[model samples]
Target: MEDGKIKGKAMVLSGFDQEESAREALEQALKEAGLAREAIGIIVTTGNGRKAISFAKGDVTEARAAALGAVFLYPTARTVIDVGAEESRAIKCDATGKVLDFAVNEKCAAGSGAFTEAMARALEVPLEELGPLSLRATQTIPMNAQCAVFAESEVISLIHSKTEKADIARAVHDGLSSRVVAMVRRVGLNTELVLIGGVAHNPGFVESFKRTVGLDDVRTAAEPDFVGAIGAALAAAE
Candidate 1:
């Protein structure tokens, strides 16, 4: 998950259908990381267990503590926005990282890594090239919608119109940032807003976000995409 690094502890849980495999993978990862076997904890529960049982599972308790640690490290974080591959989460947490309130966009691909990847592919560029390319734009092209399908269609239109790739990419960044800003605003804007998830890696996305939200201080984790896992690991440490 660290892009090649295999250091650090991890507490992992797979879906209810893959509980056994998930446990095995966590245990093996712990061993490979040279962490103490006793430091590793495994808890397998059905989806119903998570829903019906409020009790903390073995490893989950630690994961929670780790998340809290990361939260505490940032003094001004009251809102944490995580944009992942398939879904997104806007978590409103206290100083302790307790989930005070939250919203998620899990049912669609419109505002996620998948959306950006699709756009990047359509533009004939590598995903990593997107941020820098967009940053080079001299003008802002308008992207009219948050819906991925609509946006893709719009991109085609731009291409046919001879719109500059840099301009179009900038528009895409603006569109995504607007969507994320809306989600964060729902939780109420807080100082030192933290942006997590794979999308945070995109400088264009981050810059657009800062501008759209009109926030002077927007921070990103060293490993933006892995904040959840890092937070989970930090929670486990506690």
Candidate 2:
């Protein structure tokens, strides 16, 4: 960021080597901005591997970063839902972007992007195709498995029963959304709900979350995955 304005952005998948991925992403962003590493003022890191970033000037909680990022993008956003590969979180913040309350589903894969990935593989579909494919569903089917392991079994059973892949995919999203919505309820939903993190790219999960939360309008940034990084930068600026 330059003078509190976004100059460049980069999104790289978090690999087993968190520090390496972070460095790669930072380098990409610097290249995009045509800036040297020495030009950077301060570096703040957040998310699961924040502390692993050796060059970071500071680190902040994912919830705090998410709240700041959401409010920065959508000033009116009071509720923030960040769904990532390993965990999903719900944060309630005020107009000034102060986190008032928060909840996380760290223990459950059922509420995370990983669950969708597993389901997609079980259905023999690509990760990116799962969302669009689910849109063609003709009905809503219940997925009873709360565990990812058992959920895969349930999906295979449905497949054997001649159930449409679309319906099964929809059910997978619905099940995940149900878990996420329940976590959001702990923090309380507010107007101008903003969704961030990698999972925001999935239209199936977005649609299911909207339906489950009973909200027609859930806001998302153009590059939702960068929200947390933007928040970390904002924190660094301060």
Candidate 3:
């Protein structure tokens, strides 16, 4: 980020060596921006691997970073919901990105992107295609499993019962959304809901979450996955 706005962005997969991955991602970002390392100033890190980045000047909690990033992207955002591969969080904040309250579902894969990935595998569909496939669903088939392991089995059973893949996909997203909505409720839902994290890119989950929360105007940025990084940058700027 530059001049209080994003100038360039890059992403790399989190491999076994998190610090190495962070370095590679930073290098990519710098290369994309055509800047040398010395051109950069402060670095504030957030997320699960924040502590692994020894070069960072400071670190912030994931929830706080998410809140800051969401409010930065959408000034009116009062509630921030972030659903990643391993965890999902709901953060209540004001226009200034001050976190008032927060809740997280960290213990369950069923409430994270991992659940959708598992269901997608069970349906023999690629992860990226799952969302669009779910949009083709004609009806909502309630998914009973509350665990990812069992959810995969339940998806298989649906396949055996000749259920449409699109319906099954929708059911998977619905189940994930229900759990996310419950988490958001703990933090107190407010107007201008903003969704950040990799899962925000999933249209099926977005639609399901909007319906579950009874809000059609949920907001998201162009690159939802980078919100935490943007938040960290915002913190560094401060």
Backbone N/Cα/C clashes per model? 9, 0, 0
- Candidate 1 per-residue lDDT, tens place, 1-238, comes to 2322335544344455455544565567667677765654533232212333333253343224323534855656777777766767677778778867676666677777777887887788899999899999999877886788878888988999999999889898888778777887777877756777778888888888888999766898667644555554444444
Q: Note the residue pairs that clash in candidate 2.
A: none
Candidate 2 lDDT score relative to the true structure: 0.92
TM-scores, one per candidate: 0.77, 0.98, 0.97
lDDT of model number 1? 0.68
Per-residue alpha-carbon lDDT of candidate 2 for residues 70-115, written as tens digits (9 for 90 to 100): 8988998999999999999999998877899999999678889999
Q: How far does residue 73 in candidate 3 sit from its true spot (Å)? A: 1.3
lDDT, residue 53, candidate 2? 93
Candidate 3 versus the native: TM-score?
0.97
Off by over 4 Å in 1: 1-32, 36-39, 42-69, 72-75
Ranked by lDDT from best down, the candidates are 2, 3, 1
lDDT of 1 at 89: 68
Candidate 3 local lDDT, 41-151, one digit each (tens): 987889889999988899999998998888888888899999998999999998899899999999779989999989899999999999999999999889999999999
Global lDDT scores for all candidate models: 0.68, 0.92, 0.91
Worst 10 residues of 2 by lDDT: 216-225
Query: What is the lDDT for 65 in model 2?
Result: 92
Candidate 3 at residue 10, lDDT?
82
